[model samples]
Structure formats: structure tokens, C-alpha cells
Target: MRRVESLDVLRGVAILGTFGTNVWIFSSPGGLAAVLGGGGVVESGLRALSNGKFLALLSILFGVGLAIQHSSALRRGARWPGWYLWRSALLLVEGVLHFVLVFEFDVLMFYAVVAVQCAFIVGRSTRVIRGWMIAAGVLHVAVVGLLTAALYGKDVVGDDAADTSRWLDQVAFRLDNALALRAEAVFVLPLGMVLFLAGARLLRAGALEQSVRGDAIRRRLMTWGLGVGVPLNALTAFAGTDWALVDRYLCAPLVAFGLLGAITTLVHRTAEGPLRRGITAVGRSALSCYIAQNVLASVLCYQWGLGVTGGPLWTVTCFLIVSALVTAGAWLWLRRFPRGPVETVWDVLYRAPQRISSRRTRCPQGRSA
Candidate 1:
């Protein structure tokens, strides 16, 4: 399939923003333990810039890709979501491995689940799709609401953190605290469903077009998402832990839409430059870059690697340094190779089963007789 430069650029941005969020956790002395506590003034302030916005944008972009895939399938006279199930299943396996071996808070597994559910439901009647989206949105909101109220009403006491110095022991620790570590993934699934469907709908509605209609769509998103969403999100940042649910789950998504609008607009208006080209390359090799960033960051920060623990600013600096290197590396790799290393492996795995299936369905050599 042909690549969309705009989408690729967006993906690059999302990839880095996600790392921005993850760096805080990686920098903390207690990996997963940091999730339940607040950070220093500078750290918290910087965290607000990323918090939940980019992750939400990433979800929407995933939906857009799913829509594109579904379209490709239909155009080829193939069954909808036929082998797509296999694709998502592969994603789930990747996610599990990532969670256990790399980052404990991997999003791939949950995204895989949402992709499966969405593949079956997309391209249905407008009313049906809207119903699903609305239902999921409402359910997610209610759940977030209840959780927020509970947090405000009472503090959440967490267990003392265990040592996370050894790589092997860290793997064991993730396995032992599976539920606790996986809670964020589970909690975000409903929102994933909502955003995933919304993204498909947006794609169908020409959300990425560069013309008049597309401009209008983006304008509205900016008006609501930036003009309204960003402010509320900022307020929540200062509102303390109780309001974090409001900030990340609710307000952050608003800013995501706004960022999409702003970025798309900027790309269309600006001429090609090093920064744009760099991000585009990163976007093309997004999966590979994402995994590399995490693994490299772990090597730099985790006890098993460089064991570089520090305040939030230092960790954020680490994230920036890693992100820059990955972007530059991807730019260099793509110049010689069509895909990144992991992407190459992923595509091979994705198509291997299909090759076998096609071979099985082929006629024998004597078919002419």
C-alpha cells in the first residue's frame, strides 16, 4: 500500500510523545510504582504537556490504518477482516512479549484486542457504527467517572515496591504483578474502542484530505479540541490525582484532535525540510522505532542496563536523546532499506501464513490436463 506522508508524520509525533510519557516511569526508582504517585514541580509540569494526548492520538491513527486495510481488502475482492484476524493476533503476541520482556506497560496487546473487535464492525451501517461508538464512549466515561470519584473520596494505598535491578528478576516481577501492572491496559480498552471507531469514521469522512472539506473538519476539531480541551486538561493537571482521570482520559483526547488539526495544517502549509523529512522517516518505520526506543531507553535507565535513575528532568532528557537518535537512525535505515528491521520481521510473519494458505489452495501441476 502507498504511504500517506501526513499520517506518517503524525505517527512519528505520537511515537515520541509516548516515549515522553514512558520516560517518567523508566526514570523512577520503582518502575511501576511511580504510576501511583506524583512527581516534582518541573516533572509534573512537563508531564502535563504529554500526559495522555499523544497516546490517544496514536489510538485514532491505528483506527485510520485499520480503515485503510479494510478498504484494501474490499478492493481486492477478498473477505473483510478475513486474514486481518491473523494480523491482530500477531499484534497480541507482540504485545505480550513486549510487556514481559521489555516494557511492563505495553499497549500493543490491548490495541490488538481493539483492532480485532473493530475489524468486524467497521463499514457497517452508519447508525450501527455510531451506536457502538456512543455506547463505548458512554461506558468509558462512566467508568472513568466512578474511578475519579473513588480516588477523590479516598487515597489508593499501594504495596511497597520490590527491587527492579536485575533484568531477569524484573521479568519475574512483571509476571508476579501481572494484574496490577496490566490495570492501565485494561482500563483504557473501552476508550480504545471509542477512539478506534471514531478514527475510522473520521477517515471515511475525509479527515485527512487537504482540500476544503478536510480543512473544515480539522478546523472544528481545533476549535473544540484546542480551544476547549487544552484548557480543561491544564486545569486538571493542577487539580491533583483525583482529577487525573479527567485529564488523561477526557481532556487529553481533546488535545489529541487539536494536535492532529494543527500538525496536518502545518504540514500542508510548510515546505519540505529536514525536520519534516526526519519525522516522516520515523513514521514509516514507526513499529521498529517504538520497540528500539523502549529497549534502548531501558538499557540506558533500567538497573540491568546503565541503571541511570534520576529526577524527571534527567529522564525526560534521556527520552529526548533516545528519540533523536532513533529518528536519525530510522532516516538512515530507510535510505537503504524499504522497511525497518522489526517491521521487516513483522511483515514476514504477517505474510508467511498467507503464503502457506495460498499454496494449499492452488491446483496441482497437472491442472491443464
Candidate 2:
């Protein structure tokens, strides 16, 4: 199937924003609580602008990709999503490894888990899918409200000493905290599902795909998304309140969709140039770029590598530099290869079972006919 440049562009932008949101967690010696407590304009700005928005975009894009793949399979006369399920299974494995070895607070595992469930609803009627999306959103909001009421005015930050040890120790620590990781997943899964369903709905309606009608929808998304989303996110950032449920479940998704709309519309309007090419390249190799960001952050912020810790400004600077380098690297690599290294691995894994089965079927079993 042919690639959609808009999706690539949006994915690239999502990757960049994700990096911005995660930089603090990756770089801070105080962990998430410390960063949240150490309030300032720059920190607040980053929180307001990024926070949940990028992750929401990424989740939505995952659903969009599922819809695209299902549509492509229908064109080829396939009746089921066997290949897509294989892809999701592989993604779940990768997400597990990433969480255990690299970052415990990773979202990929949750995304993978939800994506497999999403596969079941891929070709459902538009009305059914829309109803599911609405129901999911409502459930998410209700759950967030309850969580916020329970966890309000609590000191959630820990005072653990900064680990100035080997990377293996860090990995071991994450493994040891497996229960905590699971708890985190339970908390975030509902919200992720809402975004996933929303993305599938949009793709089903052909909003992400280029069309004369899509342009009008995109404009509306951009206008309303930004107009409302920006202020709510900004307020959340500036307040620095510990209303995790409200921010993550409620406000963040709005900002994320708005940013998605605005970015998609802008990409459509912008003429082709090196800038567009570079961003699209980064998007094309989004998996590789995302994993690379985690590696880079570990090296630069952790004691095993640079052992450096600073404020939000430092984190933002590191993110910008890494994004530029990653974009350029992706552009260069794409010139020679069809897909990113991680993407190539994913494709191979997803197809390997089918390939082996085909080979067995082709070979003579007992005797030549």
C-alpha cells in the first residue's frame, strides 16, 4: 500500500512532542515528582504545551494505522486481520522489553495491548464505531473524576537517591518494580483506548487521508482544537496542580487532538521542501526515532553516562538537539533503505510465520505427484 505523507508528518510531529514531554523524566535526578515540584516558567510552558498531547497523538495514530491496514487488506481480498494481529503481538513484545530494560514508564506496551483489542472493531459499521468511541470517552472521564477525588492532596513524589550506578542496575530496578508498572498500565489503559477509538473513527471517515472533504474537516479540527485546547493545557501547566486524573484524562486529550488538527492542516498547506522531507523522514522511521530518544536520554541524563542533571531548559535543549540529529539520520538512512531498522524488523517478524507456512505448503510432503 502507498504511504500517506500526512500520517508520516503527523507521526513525526507526535514523536517530537513526546520527546519534549519525556525529557524531564529522562533527565531529572528527582524523577517525575521533583520535576513537577520545581516549578518555573519554562517547566510550566513545556508541561502546558506537551504533557499528554503527544502521547495522545501517538495512540490515535496507532488506530489510524490499523484502519489503513484493514482497508488495504480488503482491497487485496483478505477477510481477517491476521497480519495486523501478528504486528501487534510483535509490538507488545518490543514494548515489554523497552519497559523492563529502558524505561519503566513506557506507553508502547499499553498501546500494543489496546491495539490488539482495537483490531476486532476495524471493519465495523461507522455508526457502531462512533458509538464505541463516545462510550469510551465517557468512561474515561468518569474514571478520571473518581481517581482525582481519591488522590487529591497527596504527596506522590519519592525521595529516592539518584542512582549513580551501572545501566544494568537501572534495568534491574525496573524489573523489580514490575507490579508498579502493571498498576500504571491499569491506570492509563482506559484513556489510551479512548484515543485509539477516536483515531479509528477519523480514519473510517477518511479525515486523515487526503480528500477534498477532508480538507474542510481538517480546518475545523485545527480551529476548534487549538482555540479550546491551548488554553486548557496552558492553565493546567501554569497551575502545576497535582490533579493527575484531570490533566491526563480530561484536558490533555483535547490539547492533543487540537495539536493534531493544527499540525495536519499546516503540513497540508506547506509546500514540499527539505524541511517537510526531513520531518516526513522522521515520521517514516518513528519507531527507530522513539527508541533512539530513550537511549539518548539514558546516556545523557543518567549517572551511567553523562550523570548530568539540570532544569527544564536543559531538558528542552537536549530534546531539540536530539530531534535534529535523529531527523537528519532518518533522512540519510531512508535514502538507502525502504524502512527504518526497527520497522524492518517489525515487518519481517509479522510476515515470518506466513512465509514459513507458505514454504511448508509448497514443499512435497511424502512423494512427488
Model 1, 215-279: lDDT tens digits are 99999999999999988998998777778889999999989999988888888888989998888
Lowest summed lDDT across 10 adjacent residues in model 1 is found at: 360-369
Question: Against the correct fold, how does model 2 do in TM-score?
Answer: 0.94
Q: List the residue pairs that clash in candidate 2.
A: none
List the global CA lDDT of all models.
0.87, 0.79
Global lDDT of model 1: 0.87
lDDT of 2 by residue, 1-369 (tens): 576668998899899888888888877778776765747786777666777788888988988888788888889887667777777878889989988777777778888888877788767887787777778777877878887778678766666533546888887777777777578677777677778878877766667656788777776776666787677766666654667557656778887777777777777777878988998998999999989888888788888888777876687778877788889999999999999999998888888898998788878863576
Backbone collisions counted per model: 0, 0
* Residue pairs with backbone overlap in model 1: none
Question: Given candidate 2, what's the lDDT at residue 247?
Answer: 67
Best by lDDT: 1
